[model samples]
Target: MFNEAVTQGDDPGAAAAAHAHGILPSADFCEVVLEEPKADSHGDLSTNMAMQMAKTQRMAPRKIAEALIAHLDDKTGMIAQTEIAGPGFINFFIKPAAWHPVLTAIHDQDGDYGRCDLGKGMRIQIEFVSSNPTGPLHVGHGRGAAVGDSTANILKFCGYDVQKEYYINDSGRQIQTLGLSVYLRGRELIGKTVDFPETCYQGAYIRDLAAELLARDGQELFEKDEAAAIMPCARYAAEKITRGMRADLVDFGVTFDCWFSEQSLYDAGKVAADIRYFREKGLIYENDNALWFKTSDFGDEKDRVVVRQNGQTTYFASDITYHKDKFERGFQKVIDVWGADHHGYIPRMRAAVEACGYRREQFDVLLVQLVNLLRAGQPVAMSTRAGEFVTLADVVKEVGRDAARFIFLTRHYDSPLDFDLELAKQKTNDNPVYYVQYVHARIASIYRKAEANGMDLGGFSTDDLTALSTPEDVALIKALARYPEAVALAGAAMEPHRITYYLMTLAAAFHTYYNRHRVLCEDDLRLTRARLHLITAVQKVIRNGLALLGVSAPDAM
Candidate 1:
């Protein structure tokens, strides 16, 4: 709707004025005015380009604002009013007509309402939930999985060629610990009283793996030399845990396109080859019995070791190869979703990418903070030692995958999320998943009831959406119009939680409309049909949003 104003030679954002004034010019820039919402004083969106350029151009801000305003088409329908407020800050009052077209567009496009050509099909890789294959995913891993999965979905909707990946840590010390843990448990199961080390896994799943091994191979596996058998046992345990982890994620409705292995980097000599590249480029040097990369030069706290004195690669070493491998696959952008506890690792990894000759900005990191699972009002403590840490599968079975995914993403990725078991299981407003699904099911109910009444809505074209002019109707349409913007913002910012919040707000507006007014009133067919059009659009958005979160959008509760 606002595009008409731009096409009419009105103030076309800051870029045009900047170019005429011999200032920095960029086609990518837009002049946005932040005006009060006419209801809230917190200005809907604020930009200070005019004020910033006043001194550089040797002109007063108010004068510059007047010139910019002259170019702005007064016929811009989205702007009910535009005024210079507070030292050249242009504020705009978005007109209701500006929100009306959204309803028609939604009815015309259906579920594809929010998709845009913003990315122009740029290839992007998103790697997340690369948790070690030593145990089931904890709550921390759940957050990353939700964020990464939703992010990829949003990017795909925005016309990006997105590939979702999960990196497996199969060649690490954690795998060794898992092997020893399984072997020790196997020894106990076979009538040996070996002391089980506390450092090994004590989860019941490990015992189950040991049981499976016992059932399949008997005690022959453990009869071999300890050192000789440890690696094989660990490999077996890792495979079992990895399989279980995959099943758990699938149960949670999460799937990845690739499961890249850390072992592959070693098997292919990719890590060694990358280290040699750094060595040849003088990006790495030996100091104090350690092979250190010049990470400090690239913005790390200091230099980091690629290889330890014992001739083993560090975690950072495998990571360099992993990142390089991702870039070499021809993805223009790589996004990593990690638990916030690993925030410190970002700078180093970013530095490694730059040192390896890739653009530092090519790598994006989304730090998903912790989730505190709650069962009533109390915190749910997780412990692997007690064999009581909640698995992703357990959460899915308890509250369901749709509920699990939505609740996990209900908060901003940077903010701490509280997942209440009781609330998630509730069918009312306490559960956002149910609320959104209720709207979808209600729309289906309308369609069924209308069909039974011999009312053919398929013949009703959306070209007559102007019939929907009530305050609530317009409000609902406004929410529908924001879908594309919401999607674009979420993709650009790498924030999937925005969609969760949008669904909740949209669902609330829908339920409120449902409670107050009937969509199939016999005497009001025109308004009823129009409202159905809006409801149908709402259903598409709710279903699409839920799918992005790896949640199910059921037609019936």
Candidate 2:
């Protein structure tokens, strides 16, 4: 309706346009945006269409607003009244009947109420939690997993063809270090006096891997040359650790469409091929007896080496190849979720993307910040290198997946999160997940009560919605109407926390409405049925929002 008013206001044949000498041209030049006014007395919805067209129409904003409102086509009687507010803002007071369709649409759509076609099925890949398979996943990795997985869900809900991927850094020096750590532990198990280098991994998991290796391969492993033994140990330990990582992720409700290995890039000769391609494109050159990418030319602070003087490729080389392969596989957009420490790496990666003939905007990186695991407001000690950190599995086991994932997504991924173990487990409103899930449970209880009361368990008709004309009822419906907008914004910005925030807001609104009004009134069945239908829509939307975050909406708290 706001769009129609703008079009009519701009039509040359309209009286307002003729009065203004037909200065207003096509409405396409400016976008018409409608926002709910904070104060109900102001109006139901407000728009700045007049101000937006003031410059284009060569008229004062107040005059444009008057002209627009005079020419508004409220043919369906949707707008009960229109007011010109300060600074030429148009306020619309929509009739009570206008909000009924939103309720009907909610019932018609159900689980898909908030879903949008923003992406139009664009192929997008999101790679996250690519933690090295050297140790168990810590709380930091848990945060990344939640953020990445929820973001993927949001994109998919917005009609994007999204593939969740985990890139395995299962090659090079780290694996070598993992192998040597296990092999040294194996030697100590065999009673051979060996100096355990300080550079070796100190995790207890490594010792466990060593013990398993000794049991599988026996003492013969120690008899082989240390170099030959290290490779076998490396392969065995990486496979085991990767398997455990996969299982932990599955338990956390994050399953990847692909478990891409960094080693595969080398084994398939893609790394070497990428370097040659870059060199052919003059994006790579030799300097200091090493191959360096011209990242500086593409906005990086300095050129970065892809190959060392010792004839070994750096990790950056593999990353370049991996990203190239991602685009080659027909993904229109690629998103990498990395630790906050990798913030500096973004410029270089963007440079590489541009050099590969892709736009800088096509490649995105979501830098997830650190997570501080706390118990009762006291920090829990964690050292990944020393194997003293709390594992993601331990957190999930203690707080459950729903709580952990919800807490992880309560804030933007770029902001550091403090996951309070005690707070997450609480059933009170202090616990965000519990608070939101309770809304669903409470509505289910309402339905059960409605059934027990012998009222028709069958749904209400559209005419019943006219009973939902109270300010509280209108406010609740407006809140429900914002769900699709929240989802669309979240998908556009690639931020899943928006959904979390929306869920909390909707939950609070429902709780407020429930406390003030009785849904199953004994004296008034019409109002009761109307309120029940309203709450039913609320429950469905809450479930839909929670599903996007990979959190469950329980029938009972």
Per-model TM-score versus the true fold: 0.86, 0.93
Give the top-scoring candidate (lDDT): 2
Report backbone clashes per prediction: 6, 0
- What digit string (tens of lDDT, one per residue) describes model 2 on residues 1-557? 43343443454345455356423444644676988888989999899978887776666777777767766767788988899999999999988878888889999999889888999999999999999989889889999999999999999999999999999999999999999999999998999998988789998888899999999879998767889999899999999999999999999999999999999999999999989988998889999899999999999999999999999999999999999999999999999999999999999999999989999999999999999889999999887657788999999999999999999999999998989999999999999999999999999998887788788646667788899998899889989999999999999999999999999999999999989998888788888888888998999999999999999989987
lDDT of each: 0.80, 0.90
In the order shown, what is each candidate's alpha-carbon RMSD? 5.8, 3.2
Which clashing pairs does model 1 show?
10-71, 11-71, 11-72, 13-31, 34-45, 179-234
The per-residue C-alpha lDDT of model 1 at residue 86 equals: 77
- The parts of candidate 1 lying over 4 Å away from their true place are 1-98, 385-387, 456-464
